[model samples]
Structures are given as C-alpha cells and as structure tokens.
Target chain A: MTYCVAMNLAEGLVFVSDSRTNAGVDNIATFRKLHIFGTPGERLVVLQTAGNLATSQSVISLLRQRLDGEEANLHNVDSLFEAARLVGSTLQEVVEHDCGNVQRQGVDLGCSVLLGGQIGEEQPRLFNIYPQGNFIEATRDTPYFQIGESKYGKPILDRALNHATPLEQALRCALISFDSTIRSNLSVGMPLDLLVYHAGSLEVPQGFRVKEGDAYFEGIRAQWCSGLRQLLGELPAPPGDYWS
Target chain B: MTYCVAMNLAEGLVFVSDSRTNAGVDNIATFRKLHIFGTPGERLVVLQTAGNLATSQSVISLLRQRLDGEEANLHNVDSLFEAARLVGSTLQEVVEHDCGNVQRQGVDLGCSVLLGGQIGEEQPRLFNIYPQGNFIEATRDTPYFQIGESKYGKPILDRALNHATPLEQALRCALISFDSTIRSNLSVGMPLDLLVYHAGSLEVPQGFRVKEGDAYFEGIRAQWCSGLRQLLGELPAPPGDYWS
Candidate 1:
C-alpha cells in the first residue's frame, strides 16, 4: 500500500509520499515512491509513484534513461503537461512488457502516478496519470491530485486545499493528512518524502525526508491532534429541543 | 454507496447512517439503514446496514419477521454478542434464499452491518458482521466499527476517539466524520439517521433524522469546516532548518 499526494498551489507545487510496500502482510518492505528529475534553472519535474513497485521503478528508470536520448525527456518535454503524457506512455510500456506473467499469477497490474512541476515558462501544473495511458490535469478549483491509499487522507485536502493556499501551509496540511493516515493505517509509515517547489524556480525544490521523531513533524502531529480535540470541545452541541 | 458508522464507547453506543441509496448516479433514493430491536430496559440492539439496498432491506425484514418464531429472536438473545451472531445468521439466510437468482443475473447479494447495544446484564458491545456470516467485535483499542464508505470519515475518529471518550463528545466526532464524508461523496448525503444509546437505559435511544436545513446538523457542519480551517492555521510550520 502507498499514499502519495501533490498540490498545485499559487506559490507552487508540493509532493509527498509514504515509502512502504508489501505483497502480503508477512512480506512488507520499504521502497521510495517519490522521484525527481530536472535540469537546474530549466525545468523541475516530480513524479510520485504508487502500486506495483516494480512497475513504478521501471517507469522512473525508463524516464531517467531517456534523459540521454535525443527524444523528448522530462528535461526536454514541450510542457509540463507533455511530460505527464510521456510518463503515462512510459508506464503503459512497462506494464505491457512486465505485467503479463505477474497478472497471470493474480497480481494487480495497475499503478497511479502524480506528476507535478514547471516546464520553462509554463505555469506549474499537476496531473494524475492512471494505470492506463490516460491522465487528468488538476485545475484551480481542485488544484491537487493524490494516488494510492488516498481516501484516508483525502478529507483534509478536500476541505483545506485551494489555489491560493501558501506553499508552506499546503505542505503543513499535507503533513497533517499524512499523520492521520499513518496513525490509522500500518501500511503507510514514517520516513516520508516531501518536496516544496516555488513556481518558476524551475530547480530542485527543498526536500525533506521526515523520519520518526523528526522534531517538526512530531510537533505538528501532536499539536494538530490536541488542537482538533479542543476545537471539537468548543463547538456548540445540538440543543436539547433540537433532538426532542 | 452508503456511509454508516457505529461506535462502542464506555458511555454507550452511537450509530449514524446516511439515507441516500442509488442504483447508479441517475437513480437516487432514500432508505432507512438503521434498525432497532429491544425489550425496553431489558435489551436494546441497533443494527446499521450498508451495501446492496435490496439485500440489506431483506436482512432487516427477515430479522423482523423472525420475532414471531419459536427460535432465538432478537428479543430473546442471551447477550448483545448473541444478537450480533443472530444478525449474521439472518443475513446469511437472506443471502441463501435471495442471492441465487440475483447472482444469476450478475448482481451482488452482500451487505455489511454494524451491530451495537446492550442486552440483559451483559455490557454493551459492538460487532461488525460481514456478509459471510462472520463478525468481529470492537475492542478497547478500536472502539468503533464503520460500514460503507468508511475511509473518508475514519481519520477524525482515528485521531480523537478513545474508549473513555464521553458519549456526547463521541457523538460530536461522528457528526464531524459524517460531515466530511457527505461533503466529499455524492452518494452519501443529507437526511441522516442517528441513534444515541445510553448503556443501561436501553429502550429506543434518542433517534434523529438529520435532514437538510436541520438547524443543529447545519450548525455543526458549518462550525466543523471553519473550525478545521482555523485549527490548520494554528499548526506551526516545519522549522526552516528542519527542511534544510
């Protein structure tokens, strides 16, 4: 299981993901689900992966290997959207070549990818690429995309995320969302990867590998829990007559 | 789709279910998913149903019809745990009698039920009965059992709920969880049914059909959304050096 989220905010894009994978309860393992690709000051593309670790690794590997090709790569894609399309195709190719035997053994062939970044002068954008070759771009009203174990962490994003949300604040909310999920589910764990991008920077963003006992992450998690309990306590209860 | 949640707390039990049921997006309908069975102060059983409407309704109908039989009916169940087993068996009977024809037509014939309340001298308990006639009881560590669309509303309960939580506070949190699910999902909607049980009081605990424009429900809905926003605002950002 995996949980990966990407926000396309006014300030820029933010990406975060958990790094735990398992074929079964007894065979759990840690694997990186976030990948970064770019040329400094030119373009920065972040790809967050979920499902079928082998497929995800293959897709990212294919993209990295393409950097040396004369063909379009993350560095040379005409636009961030184009880069997203390339990712979708790359995943499709991997599935076609690798999933046949795996699926015959009753394994899932599906994978979900969230692609976010800036391409030259184009505004920062994000796309959720499906297991198939199709994808959907995030717009202003819904300027975020999440893949895998998404439901547990989605309510916070749906409620608090907006186009105008500051990058740091959006990152904070993502951490809160992650905290909620990690506490509720064992499949998603610590050592989270978070990348903060400032729109138009077109360079590697400030990245954090949040491990267990990371002071700031721990503080936010503790404060958010207590603060929520306080807020719930403050809310007015339904009147007696209302129920009667 | 549906969202129904039940909590087994030290104070008592809480059950809430959205009324909206649909065959598809175009054909939406309302149906009661919460059912009550009790002999006043002796035994009170609350059953919250989810999944196929026809199957769920049939299970409830069978249980109601069995009240006149000589066999162990809900009113005569030895304990709340026995009542849960009864519900599971009744569901299996419904599936046995009704599922074959439905399955031949490619329709699913399963439902999930959350059964919670007290019986005689036994303490209040909660069980999540699966369609296969197996059930799992809620424990101190996990005091709540949710059926249908459980994930969206789960984080809040995961963060704030404990076995020792007061009934009213738990009620407040369930409402918040329902509010989150309702906002994010089109299938789960207004006109929710909520039942609040007081451990020893039994009988038909306070029941509320929270309709659209119900002042109290509306108030909580509004207050919770804004309160969450404020809480998020107060959480401190990751330290500058933390990310570096």
Candidate 2:
C-alpha cells in the first residue's frame, strides 16, 4: 500500500508522497515514491507513484532511460501534457512486458501515478495516469489527484482545498490529508517527500524530506489531533430528539 | 452498497447506518439496514447489515422466523455473545440456501453484519459477523467496527474514538465518521438509522431515524466542515524548508 497526492493550485503545484512499500507485513521496506525530473528554467516534471513497487520502478527506469535520447525526455517535451503522455506510454510498455508473469504468481500488476509540474511560462498542470496507460488531467474545478490509500485522506481535501488556495495553504492541506491517512493506516508510514513549486520559478522547487520527529510535521500532527478533539467538544450535542 | 458502524463504549453502545441499496448506479433505491430484535427489559439487540441486499434480507427473515418457533431466538439468547452466534449461524444458513443459485446469475453472495447490544445482566457488546458466519467481538483496544464503504469514514473514528469515550461523544464521533463517508462516497447516503444504548439499562434505547433535512445532523455537518477548514488554517505551515 502507498499514498501519493498532488495538487495543481492557482499559485503553483504541490506534491506529497509516503515512502513505505510492502509485499506483505513481514516484507516491509522504505522506497521513495516521488521522482523529480527537470532542466532548470526549461521544465520541471514530478512523478508520485503508487501500487505495485516493481511496476512503478520499472516505469521510472524507462522514463529515465529515455532521458539520454534527444527526442523524448522531460527536458525537451513541448508541454506538461506531452510529458504525461510519454510517462503513460512508458508505464504501459513496462506493464505489458511484466504483467503476464507477475499475474501468474497471483500478484496484481496495478500502478498509477500523479504527474505534475510547470513547463516554461505555462500554468502548472497535473495528471493522474492509470495503469492502463490512459490518463485524466486535473481541471480547475477539481485541482488535485490522489493515488493509493486515498479515501481515508480524501475528505480533508474535499473540504479544505480549491484552485485558488495559496501555495502555503495547499501544502498545509496536503499534509493534513497525509496526517489523517498515516494516523489511521499502518501501511502508509512516515518520512514524507513533499515538493512545492512556485508557478513560474522552475528552479529546484522549495520542499522537504520530512521524517518522524521532524519538528514541523510533529507539531502539525499534535496540534491537529487536540484541535479536532476541542472542536468536536465545542459543537452542540445533537438536539434532545436526536438522543431520546 | 451500505455503510454501517457500531461502537462499544464505556457509557454504552452506538450504531449508525446508511439506507442506500443499488444493483447498479441506475438501479439505486433506499432500504433500511438497521434492525432491532429483542424483549425490552431482558435484552436489546441491534443488527446492522451490509453487502448483498438479498442475502442480508434472507438472513434477517430467518432470524425473525425463529422468533415464532420453539428454538432459541434473540429473546432467549443467554448473552449478547450467544445472540451474535445465533445471528452468524442464521446468516450462514441463508447463504447456504441461496448462494449457488444467486451465483449462477453472476451475483456475489456477500453479506456481513454488526451485532451489538445487551442481554439480561450481560455488559453491552459488539461483534462483526462475517459472511462465513464467524464473528469477532470488539475488544477494548479496538472498540468499534464498520462494514461496507468503510475506508472513507475510518480515519475519523481512528482519531476520535476509544473504549472509554462517553456515549454522547461516541455518537458525535460516529456522525463525523458518517459525514466524511457520505461526502466522499456516493453509495452511502442519507436517511440514517441511529441507536444509542445506555449500558446496563436494558430498557428501550434512545435513538432517531435521521433524514436529509434533520436539524441536528445538518448542524453537525456544517460545524464539522468549517471546523476542519478552520483547524487547518490555524496549524503552522510546514517549516520554511517545506515552502521556501
């Protein structure tokens, strides 16, 4: 199980992902799910992946392998949309090559990714690419996409985020979503990778590789827990009829 | 599809369930999933059903049928444990009687239940009964159980609930869980059945069948949404490194 979320906000793009991967309870390991590909002022491409570890890593390797060729790399793509297509086709190629054998052993070949970043002066964009090699781009109306262990964290995003949210607030929203997910689910553990890209400033975007005991993440978790308890305590109990 | 949650708390027990049923999105309809079966003073048994509507209805019918005969029924079960076992076996009987026929038409025979309440002098109890007829009681460490479309709502319960939570707080927590679920999942909807049983009382429990326009539920939903948004606003953004 894994969790990766990316938001295409009005100001920029925010990407957050957990680093835990497991074949089974006893086979747990940490593997970074967020991959960054960039060429400074020309383009910034980020991939946050979830589902089968092997399939995603294979897809990433193919994407990286293509970087050496002049025709097909993030550095040379005309737009984020084309970059998304390249990533999707690469994923499809990898799955087609490995799925048959993997499925024979009863392991699902599932993998999906949230691909987002800026290309020159164009607005930052995000896309969710499915394992089948098809994809959906986030629209202003629905400015974020999540992959894996999504439901437990979705409600917070449904309430707190919008296309017009400030970049800082969007980061807060994504971490709150992550906090909720990690608290409820054991499979998604700490050491989070986060990237905040300012719309046009394509330089290595400001971000953090947050770990357990990190002051900022720890503060947010503690405050959110007690804050929620306090908020619920403040609400009026259901009316008399609701109880009796 | 349905969403049902039941909690065993120190003050008593709480059960809440949505009333949606669908063969497909276009074939959706409403059906109450909460059922009550017991003699008021001697016992107070509540059953919340989920999964295949037909299988659950059949299981419910068998339980009701036993009430008119000489064999043991909810009214005669020695403890809530006995009541859960009875419910489980009756469910198994219903599945055995109908599964093969149902599966021939390409429908799953799935059905599960949350069984909770008190019997005679026994303490309040809750059990999650599986389709296979095996059931497990909620322990102090994990005092609640949810069935059907459970993931979206699970985080709230995981964060806010405990075995010793007061009855009123438990109701609030369950409602919050339901609100999150209903917002994220279309299959779980309004017109909910809620029952709160005070431990050791064994009398008629207090509860309501809440509908879409119910004032108390509306208030809880409104307060929670804004409360969450406000809470996120107050939390410090990830350190300067996170946003730069």
Candidate 3:
C-alpha cells in the first residue's frame, strides 16, 4: 500500500508520498513512489503512484523509455492534460500487458496515479489518473488529489486545505496528513518524499526526503500529537445533563 | 453505510452512532442503530450495528422477539460475554437465513456489531462481533471498537483516546469522530444517538439523541472546526529551506 497526496494551490503545488510497499506483512520493502519527469526550466511534471507495484514500475519505465522516441511523452507534451493522458494510457498499456496472466492468479494489476506540475506557459494543474486510462483535473473547488490509503489522512485535508492556501501551509498540511496516515496504518511508512513546486518555475525545487528521526518531521509529529491532545482536553466536555 | 463507535473507559462506556442508512445515494433514510437492553439494576447492555440495514434490523428484531421465549436472551444473559455471543449468533442466523437468496443477486448480507455494558457484579466490557459469529473483547490496551466508515474518523481516536481516558472525554472524542466521518462520507450522517454508562451503576442511563438543530452538538462542531484551524495555524510551518 502507498499514500500519495498532491495539492494544486494558489502559490504552487505540494506533493507528499510515503515510501513503503508490501506484498504482505512479512514482505515489506521501501520503494520510491514519487517520480519527477520533464526537462528543467522547460516543463516540470511530477507523478506519484499507488496500487500494484509491478504495474506502476512498468508504467514509469515505459514513460521514461518513450521520452527519447517520436511518440508523445511527459517531456514533449504540450499541456499537463496531455501529459496526464499519456500517463494514463501508458498505465493502461502496462496493465493490459500483464493483466491476463495476473488475473488468472487472482491478482490485481490496477494502479492509480497523481500527475501534477507546470508545462511551459500554462498554469500548474493536477490530475488523478485512474487505471482505466481516464483522468480528472483538479479545480478550485477541489484542488487536491489523493491516491491509496487515502481515508485515514483525508479529514485534515478536508478541513484545512483549499485552493487559496499558501504553498508552505499546504506543505505542512500534507505532512500532517501523512503523519496521521502513518500512525494509523502500518502499510504506509517513512522515509517520505516531499516536493513543493512554485507555479511557473517549470523546474523542480529542492525537495526534502524525510527519513527516520528527521528533526523537522519529528518536530511536526510531536507538536501535532501534543497539540491535538491539548486541543481535545481544552474542548468542553459534554454537559452533565446530557450524560444523565 | 453507518458509523458506530463504542469505548470501554475507566469511568464507564460511551457509544455513538450515526442514523443514516442508504441503499444508494437516492435511497437514503434514517434508522436508529443503537439499541438498549437488559433489566435495570441487574444488567445493562447496548448494541450498535453497521452494514446491511436489513440484516441489522432483522438481528435486532430477533433479539427482541426471543426475550419472551424460553431460550436465553439479552435480558437473561449471565454476563456481557454471554450477551455478545448471543448477539453474534443471532446475527449469524439472520445472515445465513437471507444470505443464499440475497447473495444470488450479488448483494451483501453481512453486518458487524459493537456490544458493551455490565451484568451483575462484573466490570463493564466491550465486544466487537464479526459477521462470522466470532467476537473480540476490547482490552485495556485497546478500549474502543468502530464499525463501518471508520477510517475517516480514526486518526483523532488513535491520537487522543486510551483506556485511561475519562468517560466524558471519550464521549466527546466519539462525537468528534462521528463529526469527521459525517463531513467526509455521504453515507454517514445525523442525527446521532449517544449513550454514556457510568460503571457500577448497572442501570440504563438517559441517552441523548442529537438532532440537526441540537445546540450542544452544533457547538461542538463549531468549536472543533475553528479550534482545529487555529491549532494548524499556530503550529509552525515547515522551514523555508525544506522547499528552497
């Protein structure tokens, strides 16, 4: 399992993803799920994936392999929408290639992807690409997309994030969301990959890789936990009459 | 879908459940999921259910119907453990009776139950009964059980709840959990049914049914939302160096 969240905010785009994947409890391993594509200062496209590891890896390899070919790829795509379509189609191609043999063994070959970044002069956009070669772009009303192990971390995003949120604040909220998910679910673990893309930069910014005991991540976790407990304690308890 | 949570805390037991049930988005309706049983001053038991509404309703109806029969019933159970077994078996019976026909149409007939209360001189106990007629009791290390639409509301409970948490605080936490679920999931909604039992009382206490305009519940919602926003703001944002 994986948890990847990306937000297309007013100031920029924020992406956070956990690095753990497991075939089973005993077969746990770390796999990087965040992939950066496109040419620096020309087009910046980020892809975060979840679901079947084999399918995602294959899709990523195919996307990278096609970059030097004549066919459209993440690098040469005219817009984020076209880039999303290419990713979606590549995912579909990979699944279809392995799905027949995989389905006979009752294994799922589906994968979900979050594609977000700037392409040339267009504004930053985010898209959630499903396994069936289809996608939906994020809009102002719903400016974020999350894939895999999403529910445990969704409440904070629902409560705190919006299109107009500053890039830094959105990054913080995304980290807290990951913290909540990692606490409740063992399938999702650190080290985490975080990227904050300033709109129109068309260049990947300096991303942070939060490993175990990383001071900033640790501080945020401690502060968030203690702060939540404090907030709950301060909230008025139900009236005595309501109990009786 | 439904959201019901029960906690066995030091002070006593707390149960909170949403009332909405839906066959589909267009078929939404209200049905109480909380049921009170056992004789006052002798034994007190409460059941909160989620899953197929028909199956839960049938299980509840059968439990009530058997109360007057010679067979053992909730009112006649020797202990809360016995009561949990009885509920579990009754649920299994209901599901088995309808499963063959219902499953032929590809509909699910499973339901989950949370049973908690006291009997005679024994301490209060909580049980999470599965559809297979098996159950697990809550322990000091894990004193709560949530059924249906649980993930969206789980982080706060994981952060703030413990066996040592006071009954009032546990109740408050349960309500907030329900609020989070309702906000994120369309399947779970109000009005909510809440019951708080004081340990050793051995009698059913007055339970609160919170409706849409209920002032206390509205206050909690307002306070929790604003308080969470304030808390997020006060927490330091990730350092600028992380983003570059």
Candidate 4:
C-alpha cells in the first residue's frame, strides 16, 4: 500500500509520497516512491508512484533509460503534457509486457503515477496516470491528484486546496494529508519524499526527505491533532434534544 | 453507495447513516437506512445498512416479518449476539435467494450491516455483519464499524474515536465523518438517521433525523469548514532552512 499526492497550485506544485511497501502485513519494506528528473535551472519533473512497487520501479527505470537515449527526456520534453505522455507510454509498454503473464499467476500488474512539474516556459502542471495508461490532468476546480490510499488524505485536500492556494500552503496541506494517512494506515509509513516547484522556474525545486521524528513534520502532526480535538470540542452539538 | 457508521462507547452506542440511494448519478432517491426494533421499555436495537439497497431492504423486511411472527424476532432474542445471529441469518437468506441471479446480470449481491443495541440484561454491543453472514464484534481497540463508502469518513474516526469516548462526542465525530464523505462523493448524502443509546438502557434510545439545513448539523458543517481554513492558515510554513 502507498499514499502519494501531488497538487498544482497558483504558486507552483507540491508533491508527497509515502515509502512503505508490503506484500502482506509481515513483509513490509521501505521503497522511495518519488523520482526526481531534471537539470538545475533547466526543468524539473517529479514522478510519485503508488501500487505495485516492481511496476513503478520498472516505469522509473524505463524513463531514466529513455533519458539516457539521445532523444527527449524530462530535460528536453517539449511540454509538460508530452512528459506525461512519455510516462503513459512507458507504463503501457510495461503493462503489455507483463500483465497477462502476471494475471495467469493470480497476480495483478497494477501501478499508478502522479506526474507533476514545470517544463521550459509551461506553467506547473499535474497528471494522474492510471494503470491502463490513461490519464487525467488537474484543473482549477480540482487542482490536485492522488493515488494509493488516497481517501484518508482526501478530505483535507477537498476542503483546503484550490487553484489559487500558495505553494507553501499547498505543501503544508499535502503534508497534513500524508500525516492523516500514515496515522490511520499501518501500510503507509515515514521517510516521505516531498517536492515543491515554483511555477515556470524550470529547475530542481526545493525538496525534502521527511523521516520520522523530523521536527517540522512532528510539530505539524501534533498541532493538527490538537487543533482537531479543539475544533471538535468547540463545535455546537445537537441540542440535548437528540440525546435526551 | 451509502455511509453508515455505528460506535459502541463508554456512554453507550451511536449509529448514523446517510439516506441517499442511486442506480446512477442521474437517478437518486432518499431512503432511510436506520431501522429500530424494540418494545419501548424492554429493548432497543438499531440496525444500519449499506451497500445494495435491495439486499438491505430485503433483510430488513425479513427481520420485520420475523418480529411479526411471535417467536424468532429480535424482540424475543435473549442476547445481543443472538440478535446479531438473527440478522446475519436473514442476510444469508437474502443472499442465497438472489445473489447468484444478480451476479448473472453483472451486479453483485453486496450488502453489509452495522447492528448495535441491547437485548434483555445484556450490555450494549455492536457488530459488523458481512454479506457472507459472518460478523465481527467491535472491541475496545476497534470500537466502531462503518459500512459502504467508508474511506472518506474514516480519518476523523481513526483520529478521534475510542472506547472511552462519550456518546455525544462520538456522535459528533461520526457526523463530521459523514460530512466529509458527502462533500467528496455524491453517492453518499443527506437526511442522516442517528441513534445514540445509553449503557444499560435497553429501550427507546435517543435518536434524531439530521437533514439538510438541520440547525445543529448546519452549524457544525459551517464551523468545520471555517475551522479547517483557519487551521491551514495557522500551520507554520516549511522551514526556511530547506524551503526558499
């Protein structure tokens, strides 16, 4: 299980991904799901994946292999959409190669990716690529995309995010969303990879590896919990009418 | 799609369910999902259903018909476990009768029930009954059960609920959970039915119908959105050491 989220906001983009992967409860392992591709001051593309770790890793390696070729890469993609297209095409190639054989063994070839970043002069953008290689771009009304264990973290995003949200605030909300998920699900754990891009910057944006006990994340988690309890205590309750 | 949650807390039991049912987004209707069976001073049993509306309705009707008969109804069951068995048996009966036929047409015979209440001298209890007729009782560690579209509403409960939680506060948490679901998914919606039971009080537990515009609900919803925004503003920014 994994929980990865990426948001496209007015100030820029925010991406967060959990690191825990498991075949079952007893076989958990850490696998960083965020992959960064770019040249400083040129272009930055962040890919966050969730689902089968093997499939996601393969997609990443394939993309890197493509980068090593004498052709288009994250550094040279003509547009953000084309970068997303390259991702979709790579995912499709992997699926076609393994899905049928995996299914015969009762295994699923499942993986989804969140591709978000800036390319040259294009605005920062985000796309959620499905297992089938189909994808959807984020729009102003829905400025974020999430994959894997998404629901637990979704309410906060639904209520707090918008196209006009500042990049810093979006990063805060994204972290909070991940905090909510890790607390509620044992399968999703620490050592988060987060990236924030400044729109049109075309460079490696500020990023972090949020491990457990990281002071800032710990503070946000504690404050968010306390704030929720305080909010709950302060909400007006149904009159004694309902309980009497 | 539906959202029904029931919790067994120190003060008593709390059950809340949304009323929306739809064949598709274009065709939606309201139907109560909370069913109560009791003899005013002797017992109070609340059943909340989610999943296939037809299956749930059939199970409810079967239970009602059993009550109409003089011997095997919930009213005659000596223990809460027995009552749960009765509900599970009814669910099994419905599944056996229609599940195969339904599957032939591409639909599943999906349904789940959250059964909670007191019977005779037994204390209040809650059980989550699956479609296959198996059930699991809520424990101190797992003090609540939610059925159907549960994810969106889960974070609040995972954070705030515990066995020691008071009935009123637990009920508030449950409502906020439902509010999150309703805001995120059209399949889950309004006119929620809520039942809160006091420990050792077998008959006629406190209850209410929380509809759109219901004063207290409206207040809480308004306050939650406001509180979330305020919290977002209050959270500290990314540390300057890492964020530019």
Off by over 4 Å in 1: A241-244, B241-244
Which model scores highest in lDDT? 3
Steric clash pairs (candidate 3): none
Worst 10 residues of 4 chain A by lDDT: A68-77
**DockQ of model 4 vs. true complex:** 0.63
Where does model 4 exceed 4 Å of error?
B241-244
Worst lDDT 10-window in candidate 1 chain A: A235-244
Better of 2 and 3 by lDDT: 3
Give the per-residue lDDT of model 2 (tens digit) for A37-73.
9988888899999998889999898888879897777
Interface RMSD of each: 2.1, 1.8, 1.5, 1.9
Going through the candidates in order, state the TM-score of chain A alone for each one. Answer: 0.96, 0.97, 0.98, 0.95
- lDDT (Cα, tens digit) per residue for candidate 2, span B112-201: 999999988788899999989999999999999999999888888888899999989889989989999999888889999999888988
Residue-level lDDT for B150 in candidate 3? 96
lDDT of 4 by residue, B1-244 (tens): 8899999888889989999998989889999999988987688888999888899999999898878687778888888898889999899889889967777888878789999888777778899999888899999999999999998888889888999987778988998999999998999999999888888866585578887888889889989999988998899988964453
Every model's TM-score on chain B? 0.95, 0.96, 0.97, 0.95
lDDT of 3 by residue, B86-198 (tens): 99989988988998787899998989999999999999999999988899999999999999999999999999999999888888888888888888899999999989999
Highest-TM-score candidate: 3
Q: Each candidate's TM vs. the true structure?
A: 0.96, 0.97, 0.98, 0.96
TM-score of 2: 0.97
TM (B chain), model 3: 0.97
- What is the per-residue lDDT of model 4 for residues A1-244, given as tens digits with 9 covering 90 to 100? 9999998888888888889999989999999998999887667889999888778899999898878677766667888899988898888889888876786887878899999887776777899999988899999988999999988889899998899988888888999898888887899999998887778777685578888899999998999998998898788767976675
Q: Model 2 chain B — which ten-residue stretch has the worst lDDT?
A: B235-244
